[model samples]
Target: MNLSEFMNTEIVAGNTLWRITGLFGLLLVGFTAGKLLKFILSRRAEQLREPRPIIAATLGAIGRAAPFLAFALGLAAGTSLLVLNGASELVGTCVAIVVTLAISWTAICLVDAPKAWMTQRAGQTESKLDDMLAPIVSKSLIATIVVLTVVQIAQILSGKEITSILAGLGIGGLAFALAAQDTIKNLFGSMVLLADRPFEVGDRIVVDSTDGTVETVGMRSTRVRTLTGHLVTIPNGELANKSIENVTKRPHIRRIFNITITYDTPPAKVAEAKAILEEIMKDHEGMDPEFPPRVFFNEFQNSALNLFCIYWYHPALWWDYLALTERINMQILERFNEAGIDFAFPTQTVHLAGDPSRPLEVGVKGS
Candidate 1:
C-alpha cells in the first residue's frame, strides 16, 4: 500500500489510534536524532580542550535540544495530517503541544547562548569583575527563562486571557511593591555604583571603617575581601551613602613625621638640623621631586622643640611607604647623634621653701 493509503486507513478507523501511532513514530525519530547529535557534539568538544566547560555545556545543550526540535516538528506534521483527515479535536491538541514545546525550546536556547558566550569570554581575562559576574548572569538568564516559560504554560493551560491576568496582578501590585521595597532600592543602588565607577572588583577601597579589595558587586550587596582574610557583605544602599576612599587611585602618598629635640638646642643648631633634613630628603630615591619635602620648626615647648617633616612618595603602596619611612627615620637618628642633637624627654623642676641641710624654722612663737 502507498504511504497516503496507509495514513488514510489509520485515520478512517479513529483519530485517537492514528495519533498514538504517529506520536510513537515521531518519538522514535526524535530519539534517533538526539543520539546522533550527541555523538557528533561530544566528538567535537573532545577535540577542543580550551573553554572546556563552555564548549561542553553548549554542546550538551544543543544535543538535548535536537530531540525536542525534532519531536516538535514531527508533532506539527502529525497534526497537519490529522487536520487533513478532518480530525479537528486531535489536531488542536497536537498543535497546542507542539507550540508549547517550541516556545520552551526557544527560551532554553536563548538563555543558554548568553551563558556559553560569557563562559567562553571569561577564559581570556584576569578581571575579577568578569569572574564574579559570569555565574550571576547565567543564573539570572535561567531564572528569567523559567519564569517566562511558566507564564506561557499558564496561558496555554488555563486558556485565560493575558489582559485578565495582568489586571489581577495590577490590583495586587501594591503588596508586591511593599514587599520588594528594599530589593528595589538595592537594585537602583547597584546601578548607580556601576554607572558612577567609584570602585571596581580587585580595587582596594575603604568604605567607612571597612577596608578591603572589592570582590564582587551583586544585585543587593557588594562583597569585599578584606585584608584580614574575611568576606564582608555590605548592603549596596548603605555603601552608596558611606564615604568611599579609593586608595588604589592615588598616585602619591603624603607622609608626615614629628621629631622633638631638647629645648636647650640652640636656634643655629635647629637651622643646621633643618638643612640636614632637606639634604636627606633630596637624596632619598623614594621621595617625589615634584612635591618637595618640607622641614618646619613648628613649635617650641618648655621641654622640647617640635620639628615636622612632610614628604610625598610616588606609587603609594603601603609596604613601600613603610620601608621608605623607616630608612629616613634611621638616617635622622644617625644624623642627630653625629650632630650632637639630643632628643628631648619630659622633665620637672621644683622650688623649695628651705634647703634640706637647713631645717625649716618654727614660726609659732612669733605668730
Candidate 2:
C-alpha cells in the first residue's frame, strides 16, 4: 500500500491513536493498582507486632514489579499496533525508550526496596548509625547505576563505541585524580572507619582533647556532640590520622591520690593509715576486687611524708568516678581525724638568734 493509504488505513482501524491511548490508560491503571497494593500490604503488616521481614520484602518486590509489568504489556500491545500500521521505525524507537525507562525505574525501585527493608530492620534493632549509612549507601548505588546506564544508553542511541569514550577519559585521568584527591581520601577514610570500627555512634571518644559522643559518620566528616552541648564536625581524613581514645569502651579506670602528712608522724602511724586506707578500699563498692587499692609511703619531704594511694575503680560513668573519688576523700579525712594524724600544709620555721633584738640593732650597727 502507498504511504498515504497506509496512514489512512491505520487511522480508520484505530491502530494509531488507540495504541497511544491504551498505553497511557494502562500506565494510570498500574499506578492506581500499585498504590492500592501498598496500602493493603502496609495495613496487613501493621497487624503483626513483629512482622516477618519476608512479608515486607515480598510486598516491596510486588510493588516495584507490578508497575513495570503493566507498562511492559501496554508497550508491547502498543508497539504491535504501530507495527501493523506500518510505522515500524516509530515502534522501534518507542520500544527502545520504554526499555530504557523500565531499566532505570526498575533499578531505582530495587535499590529503594532493599534500603527500606534494611532501614526498617535497623530501626527495630535501634542502631543509630543505620539511619545515616543506609541512605548514603543506597544513593551511592543509585547514582553509580544511573551514570553507567546513561552512558550505555547514549552509546546505544548514537551508535558510538564506548571504548573510545573510555580511552578519552583515560587521557584525562591524571587531571581527574588531582581534582578528586581530597574526595578520594575522605572516601577511603570513611571505609577505613567503618571497617576498623574504632568508635560507633554514641561512643564517648577523646580525640586530641575534643571529647564527645559520636553523633554521625559521613563520607567526608564525622559529627560529635561535645560535652558542652555543641556539635563538632571533624574531617574523616584528619580523624583517621589522630589518636582516638574511646572512653566508653574502657572497663575500669585507674586513679591516684597523693597525700602528705607531717614528717613527725611516726612510721607506725603511717602503717596504721595504710591499713585504714585498705579497709576503705575494701568497703567501697566502686573498687575493683581484681585490682585492689594499695597505699604506700612514697617519699619524705622537708616537712611532710608523702603517701601515694593507687586504686582501680569501676568507672562505668564519668560522673560516677567523680562521686567515688569525693567519697574516698571524705572517708580519708574522717579516718585521719579519728587517728589524730594531721594533713600537712607547707610551713617554715625561722630560727632566730636574738632575731627580734637584732632587727632593732640593724640601725645601730649602720650608725
Candidate 3:
C-alpha cells in the first residue's frame, strides 16, 4: 500500500490513521509550548521577586498550574477532531471534568499569592486585625472556588441545569444548616469579634475560669495558651457571650497590704512606723505620680495596730512589679528591725482562779 492509502486506513473508533496522527501531533505541540512557557515564567518570576513580589507571586502560581491546564486544553482540542463512535458523550464529559479541575487548580493556586502578600503587609503594620483577617479571607475564597467546581462537575455528570441543581442544593443546605446550627453560630460569632476589636493576638485575657493569651481566632473557635501551658480551644459562639477581662489593657497594677505592729508599741513608735513606711515607699519603683503609694495607721485591732498601705505600679509588667515588691518588702523588714519595731502575732493572756494577779470567787449552788 502507498503512503496515502495507508494513511486513509480507518482505526477501531472510525478515526483514520492520518487523523489519529494529527491528534497526537497537536497534543505534543501543546505540551511542548506549555512547558516552554512555564520555564520562562518561572525564571522571570524568580528574577522579579525582590523588586515586584506581588507580580512575581502571581506569575509563579500561574507557572505551577500551566502544565495541567495546557494538557487539559490539548486533550479537548485533539478529541474534537476524532470520531468517537458511541463514546462521544463519555469523552466530552471527561474533557469537561478535566477542564474544570485544571481551572480550579489554577484558581486555588492564585489564591495563595494574594494571601501571602496580605500576610506580609499585615506583618509590617502594628495592628493585628489584618494578621487575623488574611488567612480567613484566603480560606473563604478557596472554599468558594471548590464549591463552584463541584457544582459544575455535578451538572456535567447528571446532565442537569445549573438552576435546578442550585435549587436542590438550597434545600439540602437548609437541612445541613439546621443540623449544624452551632457551627453557623460560631461563624457569626467570629464576625462579631472582628467587628468589636476587643482583644488582639497575644493579649492576656480572663474568660470565666480560663486565663490565657490569645493565640489565634478562627471561624469556629479561638485558641488560648493558658498560664499553665495548656491550650484551650473555645468556640467563638460561647466566647462572644462570655465576659472577658483583658489584663493587657490595664494601665497599672494596684496592691493593697496591711502592716501590723504589737499593741504594746508606744504612740511615738506608732508615728515612727508610719513615717518609716512613708520613707520606704516614697518615689518607689514603677510608681505612678498620680497614684502614689500611701501609708496610714488606719485601725487599732484587739492585739495590734494596722497600717493600711496601697500603691499603684505603672506599665503593669507582672514580673517587674513582683521584683519591685520583693525589694520593698526587704527594705521594710530591715528598716523595722533596725528601729527595734516588732511585728505583731496573735497572743492571749489568762488569769487562774487562785493567781496573784487575779482572784476569783466561786459560789456553789445546790440543785
What are the clashing pairs of model 3? none
Model 1 segments more than 4 A misplaced:
1-143, 349-367
TM-score of each: 0.71, 0.71, 0.85
Q: Per TM-score, what order, best first?
A: 3, 2, 1
Clashing pairs in 1: none
CA lDDT of every candidate: 0.75, 0.74, 0.90
* Model 2 lDDT, full chain set: 0.74
**Native RMSD of candidate 1 (Å):** 5.9
For model 2, state the Cα shift of residue 343 in Å. 2.5
Query: Residue 120 of candidate 3: its Cα lDDT?
Result: 78
If the candidates were sorted by their lDDT against the true structure, best first, what order would they fall in? Answer: 3, 1, 2
| Best candidate, lDDT | 3
